[model samples]
Target: MAKKVALLQGNEACAHGALYAGCSFFGGYPITPSTEVAEVLSGELPKIGGKFIQMEDEIGAMASVIGASLTGAKALTATSGPGVSLKQELIGYACIAETPCVIINVMRGGPSTGMPTGPGQSDVMQAMWGTHGDHAAIALVPASCQEIFSETVRAFNLAEKYRMPVQVLYDEIVGHMREPVEFPEPGELEVIDRTAPSVGPEAYKPYDTSFGDVPPLAAFGSGYKYHVTGLNKAEDGFPTTKADLVDAEERRQISKVKNPTALADIESNEEYLTEDAEVIIWAYGSTARSSRYAVNELRKEGIKAGLFRPITLWPFPEKRTAELAKQAKAIVVPEMNLGQMILEVERVAMGACKIAGVHRVDGEPINPGQIIAQVKEVL
Candidate 1:
């Protein structure tokens, strides 16, 4: 039997991926480069008997997602940079409250509505640090429309499994670009939901560690009433300022994603012809597509070149990156922004190899020719 496929835009793929992942609630306002995601869901969610709400603004959208997710619904929201800035506070709230939700941030030029049409990867760091306080973040960056759909599904899985917010960030190029996408059958792709508590309502706790680091979360109206707060909290989900309890809880939250065993399941990357390459291109999102092209071009010229693309952005893929830094003589990082992800590569490289960046922020993408030139210049 042949599977049905469609020439779908990246945003469209994301919407279908959410449905495939069992997302029943969508709370988002329309924003450029990402509007299609909400537009598609607004129509499709109702058809599937799910809920879709166009909130007043980005903040309200984020708030609604948190509320919906607490009721045991797989919730999601999509926005660009400006909208993301507005949702930062609520993003932090979701963090402290330990809710599971997915946020799709399509990167575009700007600090504040800079260039809506011009794609940018400047939001990479913000995805990790936009929210206040000390908390762990899981963010994914995919280069193509197919990856956008697949990674969006994975983003939901990570959020539900870890009991935290997980984000999928891509540039306007990939978000608006059209590509052939094969829809996964109902059971083709894995869908993960938050762990449910086995205990009766009388003994349920939102952040119970007795069930292990990630406690089972019971639905809000499931006859289980538990406190959730922005302030530091104890295991019972109530506020706690006690030094030992606060320290333990905070550490546990961050460690859940940072722990070696946990990180193995969270961090993802792709390396191309890196075994004997002297120059490696370290890039993500749309820039990585160009980098991959440059690697092929450089290899043709007898320069051993390869690409190391990060699929999971948050945990930073530190270990694998460090290994590549040591193996390669130099690494070239070209991004839509001045130089955001390059900073992380340098930190992990720590003088292991020479690193340089090719940056452009004029609402244009860095071309493969430019990446190849940088590789030669470094060589």
Candidate 2:
């Protein structure tokens, strides 16, 4: 098969990822860095008989996508920092209701509309714990345009397979940068459609634990009718005040999604000058790109340094990192946020190896030369 190379931006690749993932609907409000995703989807969805709507605001955009998912469509929405904060309530609703959908947050610096065009990974903690109640959520971070394309497909698969809302966490650098990416031809991949109940309406239970941890979803227009609401309820989708039932409902919501072996896992790209070296550089997202360049420069100077890139930001790759920590002399973590993911690196390292953080949150990326200097100091 001949490969076709198209120079594409990260946001456009994300739109293509949704189409390939069987996303038939998109609802979003335009915001910088992330606006391109909504713009591209608005144009592409219609050609494939999919639907696109620009809602009045971010909350409406989030609410609408969840509603569409009830009709058995794989749905999506995109936003930046401020918009992501606006949608947290409905995001919680999607979590409790086990709605299958994808939310792409192309992050920018901010507490409230910080910088529209600049890059920042400030939303890392929010992506995992932003919603009101205690619930398990998965967020996938992509560093490059290729990863944006591939991880978007995985985002949909995780959402539908487990019947939950999943996030694709992209920074501004990846959202706007242009790169070459290859698209899979039709029928080269597997898509998981939401499982529907085989039984009649009377026998159907909304949270049917007997079948599997996941209950089969019944579409709204389907004759097998069911009710869905935000209130804490039992398996049949009805509101209940019973204490134990509410406890059971909440526990299942988290446990079913939080199992690291079952749901959360990490992806990484590493180089092994560490086999004989003392220092290691741990980074991800756009920072990983810089670190990659820095590591090669270190090698040129006869410095033994290795790079460890985490593709799965959440669940934080504890097992692999613990093993890497034992062998290295020192670990350096560089991120756009001030000491966010660095805490995880320290926890897993357990003082067995010296760990230091190189972080900046002023909306500028860390320089590769600065990273190379940090590596040389440790060596």
Candidate 3:
């Protein structure tokens, strides 16, 4: 059979990728710029024997996804910034309870109901720390419609593998932009499912510590009957106030995702013209698209500029950034927000290289000209 190629919006690609990644349940409320994700899934999931529910609000949508994931379904939900705020408690619940799920945040201008149709990257920090408490987060930012599709699949795979919620963050520009996306033929793309309990029901412990950092998850009705709660819990999954047990559980949750090996597995970035360039531009999402163009143009003019685009937002890809910092004389970060990710770059670069920020927040995207000017200024 010929490969399927379609001109799809970012939201449509996300839904398609979720389905291809074995997502069987979707629960989301309709929000501008992200509603298409729910709409697409609502129509497509039923045809494939999966389920889709339009919830009353973002909080309900988030809770529904957690419930679905508990039943061993690969569940997903889509929302924008305000919706993400409403979903925070449940997101934290999923973290503490160790439920595996995916959340897509098609970012719009923010704080309150800022701008529904405009783009913003202000949620970069929120994606890392919006949910209360200490827990590791995994967020993937896609630059193009095609990447949003592929990264959605990667998000589900990481969520299941790490037993946590993984977020896909794209801005309004990418979300509404339409482009041709070629999906892999069946069996061409690798799909990962959660590991089932190896022991008999009588011996199963949902949060078993004996196995390793990530214990296998048992389905809710699979006869395991393990307890799950937001309160700090023990290895058996029951809530506890015991300081020692609480401390241990928290550490395990952090370690599970932060383990060097696991972190390396999930980190992704793109490097263009960095090999011999003196100035490197750091960007993500739609901003990277402009930065890439600027870098190419600068290179042609005999200015040694490069581009570093991070796909994995959380876990920040600091190691790779630091490595590049060692080689480059200056680093320029252009983001749609008023400098959310630049702080991260500055921290990682640590005086190793001169760093500059190009920020835009008038509900407009940072263009290649703006990025090129910043690159020149820094040089």
Candidate 4:
């Protein structure tokens, strides 16, 4: 049978993708470039018997998601830059408690309401370090409307599989632009739910690492009652002040996604003609679209230019990037902000390649000409 397809804005695709992933609850406060996600879900969730709530603020919205997720609801929330800032404290709570919830952050200009309707990739670093702690982070950056749909689904899977908060961020240009999205049939795309504890309520601990670093998460009121807290916890779920236990717990949480095995599954990127290229364009989100155009133009002129787009921003794609840095003589990074992701590219390149950046934070999208010019100068 032919797949059902539609012209969808990135935000609408995200809403439908969440539904496809069996998301049962959405708790969010409306914010520019992302409000459509809430609007679409508002009318659709009830028809499917799912719950949708608009909280008084971003913090409340995020808090509601973590709370509902505790009850095993495949919960999600949507917001932009400012809202994300407000949600950071609770995001930290979700991380430490090991809650599985998805956050859709439509990228807009920032530093406190910089540009509600403009595109910005400045939040790239915030997604990893915004919560203020030594915890693991999984952030997906999709460059198109169709990818936003599929990556939203992938975001939920990673959140559940890793038993933590996962973020999906796309620029406002991608979020509001319309494109055709082919919907995946039932069972076509992989859907992962949090593992359930096999042990009965009599023998369940929320942070039981004996089952592995990522232990099964039992839903609240599902015949399993376990303590959930923001404080450092032992395997039994109670707060631990012991230095050894605290140190071990912290290490375990970060190692869950930082280790080589975990990084292999969490890191994703795209390489276009990078094998023989002398200059590589490193971009993500909407800036990648322009970089692709620049690469083609440069190739037509007989220049060795390629594009390396990072789909999973966090986990950094360090190893592959280091390889690219060695293979290419120069790396050009174009982003919607003043050198946000360029920092990551530079750190990984470690002076192995000539690195340059094309930055724009003045409420404007970075164009192909800008990327092309930067690539030329770096070469």
- List lDDT for all candidates, in order: 0.93, 0.85, 0.92, 0.92
- Which pairs of residues collide in model 3? none
- Residue-wise C-alpha lDDT for candidate 4, range 346-376, written one tens digit per residue: 8988999999999998888898998888888
As a TM-score, model 3 comes out at 0.98
Q: If scored against the real structure, what TM-score would every candidate get? A: 0.99, 0.94, 0.98, 0.99
C-alpha-based local distance difference test score of model 1: 0.93
Q: Tens-digit lDDT track for model 3 on 225-307?
A: 88888888878878889999988988999988888999889999998888998999999999999999998899888999988
lDDT: worst 10-residue window of model 1: 203-212
lDDT tens per residue, model 1, 332-377: 9899888888999999999999999999999889999999999999
Clashes of each: 0, 0, 0, 0
- In candidate 1, which residue ranges exceed 4 Å CA deviation? none
> Order of all candidates by lDDT, from best down to worst?
1, 4, 3, 2
Better of 1 and 2 by lDDT: 1
Q: At residue 355, what lDDT does model 3 achieve?
A: 93
